[model samples]
Target: MKTTSYISRQVENLKPSGIRRFFDLAAQMDDVISLGVGEPDFVTPWNFIEQSFHALEQGYTSYTENAGMIELREEISNYLSGSFQLDYDPNEQLVVTVGASQAIDLALRTVVEPGDEVIVVEPSFVAYVPIVSLAGGTPVTIQTKAEDDFKLKPEQVKEAITPKTKAIMLCNPNNPTGTFLNKEELQQLAKVIEKNDLLVLSDEIYAELTYDDNYTSFPSIEKMKERTILISGFSKAFAMTGWRLGYAAGPADIIAAMVKIHQYTMMCAPTMAQHAALEAMKNGRQSVQEMTESYKQRRNFIVSSLNEIGLSCPNPGGAFYAFPSIKETGLSSAEFAEQLLQEEQVAVVPGEVFGSGGEGYVRCSYATSIKQLDEAMERMKRFVEKRL
Candidate 1:
């Protein structure tokens, strides 16, 4: 018998999430203003919680269908069509998953055979590359530069394409950076996608949190729906991070493949969450708008404060993050994040953990309260003034 370690090489080599590390560190300390975790500060709305409680009282605790309840699927179908002009058959084209993260995993596993090259744009979420690797695919990166506003250009996609290229993974109103590609930009990228015959995994979890009308759903483009797997969830816009609910809509055949894997691995999303999500889809627009407006206010304040504090930050169009360059502090992203946490008791994530093009910057999520943000900014200013 061959002697080898019990743990698979793939699992063993995976890096711990940098975001989680800082979040945990902050959790252990007192009086730490946390801008490290990318979660909403608002609690899940009471109405949604009430719906879940009602479901439980009605004894609806059993597992749902592997693809989720038919009613929830229909609501999801209607949402995409009405919001993004993307149509998908509820029965054959959509499958609710544990979260958008799980949907991303299932989508990659369904289509990416071993040796397939998945083009990943960075600085992106830390999970994208690792998930691609776990699905037995290679992650080819396209580095979006800060000077260019971190937009993914068509020529960059064209240059990254290879014969083995399977798909491109994108996070619209992207995490860590909060940079979103507008309609014109998507049109240009669509040209390259059509030319290369590639697929797209569009993660639009923050779709409803746009600061303006600049956000464009990827699959809404001409003929792009057929080649795209649209992943979204209630975590961001609806303040349902703990609910563990998300869904994917794509081509029927592709969805079926994903459902097959999901059935064996996850079976179905939480029945209670599915019920709450149904309520959210039916009557949660007002709440969403209110939360979005608050985030916009925080975004403005944070960007203005970061600039005054000697950190150069871009105005993020959407999502609740402020990606500020800490280069002026004469320290790397990790160094800045560490010293800030130690000295000022402000927790922000080091940009390097998000992959290439992330160095020299830190991702500070403005998803917390205005008062916390104000104090964190003051502490950051004190820290940076000493070095500058």
Candidate 2:
């Protein structure tokens, strides 16, 4: 049997992740500076590491309960309540997964039936559209505009809804653009969601990284608890990306269904990771605050520097990314990214990979140290000046 012929058409047709390719390229180079991958550059918090080690020493190396250990789930429930004023029952509403990535996939697979249409906001995380497709659903995109701060509009959401529409996936403190839906913005969308009787899959992995104001959890809104599935994890704020742990909280029935798929496919998230997460929930707030402060500083510097150098970048309200328009340079996002990598040894992700609305922009992650960022900025400035 031919290897290529044996692969399913769906698998064959899927394009590799744009972020992964640039990250891989940077890895192969000696002096390249990357603002490509969305992960935090910080190591996992020391307390988390200490607890994980303690857990290993105690022989806590088995799989947890299918839904996750009771203690960890309770900690997650309490953390959500204390952090965002959102309430959930650990036994009925939460399931710990391998990571936020797995939580997303499990959510889609649980709700999306063959041919269902799922509304996905564009300039979003790359995984949403593909995950919907893999779950046998149609992805209908709502392309947010750069001028609008890349925030999804209520009217746009209303217009995209169809008779076949089943759900909408939201990435708050959105990736690529680093845009967030403030309370009023969420209220506007809430009206549309309630009017259409639709469900929401809220990805709040970067919830702790919001700047300018406190972040409001979608499920915290009035009457939204039943309609919203909230996904969050320790990867971003706690700098624990490699730990591969995350959890989903939502309506009991929906979460239960997701747990079924998770039970068969994943069995459970790692027990040791869950132990560390429990400790994080209890004592990691200070570590999260410190990391967020660092990212905010980097954000301010990078955004200011980019604008000073001629690129127009919106002030991202949350997350550690700045999406800058490269339209003025008359180069496509992909072209600009390619030229920057080749010419200045700076690596950035082309915005178009986030979908069509991203065509004229590129995403710059400010999660690196200020020294690296300063060097990257100098190189990027040089690249822009030469073009101008």
Give the Cα error of residue 21 in candidate 2, in Å.
Answer: 3.7
Residue range 1-388, candidate 1, lDDT tens digits:
6545877999888888877787777788888888987899999998999999999999999999999999999998998888788788999999999989999999999999999999999999899999999999999998899999999999999999989998999888999899978999999999999889999999999999898765679999998998999999999999999999999999999999999999999989999999999999999989999999999999999999999988999899888999999998899999899899999999999999898699999999999999999899999999999999
lDDT of each: 0.93, 0.92
TM-score of each: 0.98, 0.98
Give the TM-score comparing model 2 with the true structure, all chains together: 0.98
Number of colliding residue pairs in each model: 0, 0
What value does the lDDT take at residue 159 in candidate 2? 90
Per-residue lDDT over 1-388 for candidate 2, one digit per residue giving the tens place of the 0 to 100 score = 6699988998788888777776676777778898996899988888888998999999999888999999989999889988899889999999999999999999999999998999999999999998999999999999999778899999999899999999999989999899988999998899999999999999999999998888999989889889999998989998889889999999999999999999999899988888889889989989889989999999999999999999999899999999999988899998899889988999999999999999999999999999999999999999999887
